[model samples]
Structures are given as structure tokens and as C-alpha cells.
Target: MSSILYEQSLSFKRPLDFVFTYLADHSHMSDWAPSVTSASKTTPGPVRVGTHFDIQMRFGLSDLSLDYHVTALEHPQYIELKGKGETFSIVERLRLEGEGDHCHLLYQIEVYYQEPVSKLVRFFSPIVKSSIKKDLVYLQKALDQQPSSWKPTLWSKMGDRLLLPGMLHFSKKGFASAKDRWIGVTEDLTGRNIVITGPTSGIGAAVARQLAKLNANLIFVCRNEKKALIFADALEVEGYPRPRIEIADISSVLEVEALAARLLEKGEPIHALINNAGALFNQRGVSAEGLELSFATLLLGPFILTERLYPLLKKAGEARVINVSSGGMYMQAIALDDMEFEKEDYNGDKAYARAKRGLVDMTELWAERWKEDGIVVHAMHPGWADTAGVSAAMPKFYDWTKTWLRSPEQGADTVTWLAASKEARETSGLFWLDRTPHTTSMIPGTRSAPRHQSLLRERLEEYSQKLSAVASQSFR
Candidate 1:
């Protein structure tokens, strides 16, 4: 297919977020687009920058799936995406404008054919126009009858209980369904200071982006200044305030303590502290602090950081501490006796899961201990998110579940909700997934014993003392 640029413009009486969200979501593509037989988000998350989709369209005697990648996006304002197939490629640009009761949409698309498909390009132009025109009619009709009762439906909840089907809720479809009940965060966070560890990528980056969008004062705890600067620059270019960076390797207890000291020295009243830095090491390794890498990063680092920041959290009044745990923790309980995995073979995933389990237990303990301090502590599982950590640490699992894994944004959703939502403000000490409180343990074997949380607290306290003593000696 040569260059036949197709352009279309439409006006609607709906708000931009409404129209844009509807069009951007690919799950219901077959409902309005005649040629599209099926469509699904191939990537995790809602349609936004970096999201991908697979669209299958039937044309007379042939059908093909076009894999689309979103190249650029500016919220509800503008979007550009490209789709490639076995025989051809396509470019699509969607722009939205106006506000309140009226909105304007400009849709542009172009198609290119390769090799054998080049000869059949002549007959495809008319088909493209007809498809778009028909799509507009059905789309408007569908929008006119759009249901407002998008509040929690029962079928999806049933999916949450079943094992195989429950995995579906970990994908983009689950995020889309969860969006049904979203009224969206109404709070203006202009003066709210939120601290996020590991804000350079994955769920931490996503959560940071959301907070920036809400105008919160952001403080990022990053190990690499270069990556943090690049990420902050991108945020600034996108019209968000550049996040203030605090350098620290959260995987090392010494660095974490120093990071906490610097933050406390500033005396900023932190509205929310998100302990999101973590990694799954494929092989067992120990930090300079002598703690196992996974143990230090996932549990001890966050524990020390949160403990040192207690006064600032109380100063903010009604502060929040959101610990980003993982669904993998459901498989492992806290190996209190062998936290470093020194007695047996070191399987990285199991070590990571155990640390996460301990982190969850500590969350409940902190919530109760700090309840009078006006600091709410909560733990949440991101639910099989596809991130760089997953790809690097568990390639086999990533390859098997990549298509269905939750995007960084989807994984970060509950974290942002816990940080900003009024409903979340009413609760404490719960393990959450998709905005609802969930059981701390799914498997019976993973359940903590009566003394487990106590031991976890005691051990972390011991580590805290060691960190403080080491820091004091270094200062001397």
C-alpha cells in the first residue's frame, strides 16, 4: 500500500476524558469497528505512552492481526500509534480538544503495503474509508447509551476467586474493569510531599508520574543520578514538575540510613513514603552491609527508611506509608531462621518472595504501632506486573506470562490509590490488590505462624541497631 492518507474529524458533546478513554481502550474494538474481529491490549495498563495492542481485522477472504505500538501520548489531548502486520504497516494519530460539554477529535491514519500486498493496495482505499465511516456511526450510538453504573460488577469478582481466571484480573483487562469504579483522584496535591524509592522505572516510575500529574511535591530516592535525571526531564517536558532526587542504593543498609538522615535533616513533612525499590537476584549475593541482596532491598532497607522517617510522617499528620509487596509472596512465608538463605540452595525468586512476605507482616505491625501516631501503613501486591526486573530475573516466567502481565501503570494503580484516595484514608493495616483489601496469604503454607510477625520485627530491629552503630562509627 502506497501513501493514501486518510483523515477524519468529529465533534462530540462528551468530555475529553470520556471520549478519549473510550476510544483508547481496545478491549471493545469489535463492538464499533466493523472490520475488527477482535482486539486486545498486548501490553499491561490503559492506553497511554508505550502501551501496545493487537488488533485482528477480517477483510473479505483474509484476516490479519496488526500489532500496534503507541509512540506518543499526551493524556486526553493527543496520541500517535503505529501498527505493523505481516504484510503491511499503519500509522494512526488521534488528537482531542475543547472541554466540558463539547469535545473535538481529529483522527488521521495512513497505510503501507509490503511485497505481495503492494499489488492489492489499489482496492483497499475504499474499504478503509467505508470501515471508518461505519465505525463512527456505531461508536456514537454506543456512546449515547453509555452506562454510568460502571461500579464493581460481579462477574469480574468471580474471576478474582478462581485460580486460572484470577490471573486474567492481573492483565490489562483487569485494570480496565477496575477503572469502571474509579471516580478518579479529586485531591489537589500541590503542597503534598511524597517520597518514592526506585522512581526510575517500573511501578515506582508510574506512581511518581501520577503524583506529578496531581501536582505533588516529589522526592525520588534513586541509585543512579543519570537515570533519575532523564526520567525527571521527561516528566518536565510533559508539563509536570521535575522531581527532586535523593541518591541512595536502597539495597544497602548503610546507604538507606544515610538517605534517611539526609531526608530527616531537611525536615520536610512527608505526606506519603512509598517503599518500592526491589529486585530479584538470580544468584545469591550479599551487600556491603553483609545482608542478602534480596533481603536488604525488599525488607530491611524499607524498614530502616520508614523507621527513621517516623517523626516526619507524624509531622505531616495522617501520613501514609505504602509498601509495594508482590503476588509472588503468596508462595513463601518468612524464613525467619534463614533469612539470608545460607543453609540451603539460593533460589532468587523464593528469597525475594520471603522478603516480600516479611515486608507485608511488618506493614500490619507498623499500622498498629503507629496508629496513634496518625501514620497509616499498608502493603499491596502489584499482581504479576511485567517490568524489567521480571524480565531480567525470571526470563522463563516473563516469556510465559508477558502478554498477560500487568503494565507498570496497572501495577502502580493501587499504590497511587493508597497514597491519594479518601477511601484508603479510612483504612489501615490491610494488604490490597486492585483497590480492595485482600487476604495476606492465599496459600495455607504461606501463612505466618503466631510468632512470625514478632520475629520479623525483632530481626529488623536488630538490623536497625547494627545500621545505626555502623553509621555512628563511620561518622567518628
Candidate 2:
């Protein structure tokens, strides 16, 4: 089989020099290229012809590790790199041409697949070309940002580890403060209809207050009406608008469906939906739908609610969905077989972690699918927070890690940022923490394969539709 060649070109709304400068800095490759999971300069000193770097990219179910060496450099006009790997060799060329203020980028990719793989490459050429053009859009957007934003500081590289010890289980409120984490944040969601679950306490309560300050019309969904009403009263006393309240046990799919129905009936466009209601139960329990409690609350309920509310979200033109997941999800794999914990002995922590994992996974799929509809879905973990839920659920660990735990306000910072920030709207389907996007999986075995991830999304949609039909029939 002959070598496969895939090429694409794009015109960026930036100067030729500016585009060249940004693209020359290979460190920013991961930010723009979705397939490039990670990259690093293996060779030291400034980048020039013959300088070497390594990149780990996604190739279907596996990673394609490649070493790239700069072969040619023609200053602001042209540059080329040659990559060698186990299964393939690649030659990438970028030729920049200036046209007034903008630059036309002629990018070409030549792949020499080793033997048996060339046939497969030929078959997927169309999809490959499409993905290349899609990645170019991300590249264009990233280049539009200030060059300074592309560089990471020394402290950011540590990511809160120095300020807090590894023994700490949660994120600290004051930790990211030194960086002025929320500086330049001025999102006024005034008059926007924002729905938030579990607004009675902890992160949810914190987010509600923040959004209220922004004059958003908040609609609180919670199992406890009294707590929600009390919170609303406090808001009202503080001169904030009285927020609309809806009572429902979020752990129950039927209740979530009914709640969605009421919201739909109102016909108001929902600007954003934040799925912040979650719990780590010490004992195993099933929801009204026979789903495990943690699975029901953390994953299933939010999934169904988001699925049902699609019409309202679309109606908002550019609405966002934020799923409040937990950093604890890093510890576990997506237990597809034991999603409900039916087969194995139920461990509440594992169940909670698995459910959060499922939620994050679904967020990725939803973001990809809903982008065309102008809807963005994102999942973020609150890190470690000093919340009543934590105190009650895991007391001993809480007692030890309490000193390092984030205040509810600290925990809600990223959630509020995601809900309100314009910069965040640029990217979707990413797992976020501390206002920065992080990889969904750190440990090798924990990451869900692409095929399995797709399967899970399908299964979730099927279940949501099935339950929705049942709920509709019962309502009749």
C-alpha cells in the first residue's frame, strides 16, 4: 500500500508573524489538537531545525507514541517536522502566507503506515480529513488568545500540591486565591433563568448565592423544600430576588422527570442547568427506579433531567450545562457492568466514585453531540470541600483533612466560573478543576476506551428515553 496523504488549510484572523510565533511553540499543541493527549520537548534549548520533541496522541482505543524532530525551518513562512513511531511515520508541513491582517495556513500531513495498517488508514481518510479541519478550528481559537495565556507558571505546574499536602483529600479555598484565580471575571447573567440542583447547602448553596449576586433568576431544585425555602428567605432578606423553588428527590428518576415536565410547562428558556446534587452514602440503597442511590443521584437523575430539558436549553440559543462531579472519580474506572453495584458487594465510596465517573464521561459525549445546537456541557470536581455532606458522610477523614478542605465558596468558584464565563464557552466536553481543564483519566486502566464510552452514551440515552416514555404514560 502507498503512503496516505491528508492535507487541510485554514485562514486565521491573525497576522502571519503572530500565527507563526504561537504555532512554533509546540507546548501549546495539546490545547489545540484533540488527538494529542500530551507533548513535551525531549531535547533542551530553543526550538530550531533538528530540535526533538515527543507527543502521545490518541489512536482509536490506544495511544500512538511518536518522536518528532524539526527537519526544516524557514522563519515566518514555512516549517516542517518529521515524526517516527512504531506503526507509522509522519511528515507535517505548515506554510504560512500573509494576506493583509490575516494569515492563510497551508497544513499538510503525510503518513507512511507500516504494512498492514496502510489499508486501515486508507479506509478512514475521509474521517481523518474532517478531524484535521476540526482541530484547525481549535487551533485558530487558541491562537486568537493572548500569547501569555499559553505559557504555564512555575506554581501552576505544581497544581496546589505545595500549598496543601497529599494527605489532604479536598481542594482548599485560599489555595488558588494567590493566583487571583477569579480575577477579570465579570459575567453578568442578569435576568437569565438558571436552574441548580441541591442548592440547600455546600457547593450548591454557594453557587446560588454567587449567581444571585449576578442578578440571575435562580430556580432551586432540591429534595428538602424547607431547607430550600429557608435559603430563599435568607436571600430575600439580603435584598436578593426571591428565587423560584421546586421540590423533588433528585435520586428518583420519576421525580426528576416530573420536575422537568413542570419546567417545560413554564416555557421559559433555561440559560444553564447545574447538576450539583450528589451524595456519598454509607449504605447501599436503590432509587424508585431500582437504580443504585449514588448512581441515581450522581449520574442517572442528572442524565435524565438534562436529556428531558434539551428543548428548553436549545431555546436559550447559547445555554450551558454544568455537572458537579467529584475529584474522587479519579480513583475508579467506569464500572459499566456494575454501574448499579448489583453484581458485587456494594462499597459506597466506590459506588459514588463510579457514578461521578459516569457523569463526567457522559458530559464529554453530550458536549460533542450538543455543540451544533449551541449547547455546552462540562463536568467539574469541587476538589475537597468542607461541607456538611463530607462531615456527615466521612467524619474521621473529614476530621483529619478538614484543615485543608475548601470552604463551600471556594468549592463553588469553578462551578460559578463555568456557569458564567465567556472564555469557558469556547471549549466543551472537558473535565475541569480550579478554573483549568484537566485530563479525565490520570491512571492508565481507569480511562474508558472510546468504544466503551460511546456504548455508555448510547445506553444512557436509551434508558433516559425508556424511562421518559414510562413517566409520560403514568402522567396520562
Work out candidate 1's RMSD over C-alphas: 7.7
Residue 399 lDDT (model 1): 95
Residue 210 of model 1: what lDDT? 72
lDDT of 2 by residue, 31-93 (tens): 457666546566654568887878777656576888998898887999899999997898999
lDDT of 2: 0.78
> lDDT score of model 1?
0.80
Candidate 2 clash pair list: 170-384, 171-384
Weakest 10 consecutive residues, lDDT, candidate 2? 177-186
Residue-wise C-alpha lDDT for candidate 1, range 1-476, written one tens digit per residue: 46557888888776777677666655446444656655666675345777788887766667778888889878788878889988778888889997886888888988888878688767887886777676665555454443222223565556545666567766755665554344444345789999999998988988897787667899999999999999988778655677999999988777887888888899989999999999999888898888899998999899999999999999998899999998888779899889899999999989999999999999998999999988999999888788998899889998998887877776887898789766777778988877767777766778787588988899889988977799778866
- What's the TM-score of every candidate structure? 0.71, 0.66
Where's the lowest-lDDT run of ten residues in candidate 1?
Answer: 143-152
Cα RMSD of all models vs. native, in order, equals 7.7, 18.3
Best by lDDT: 1
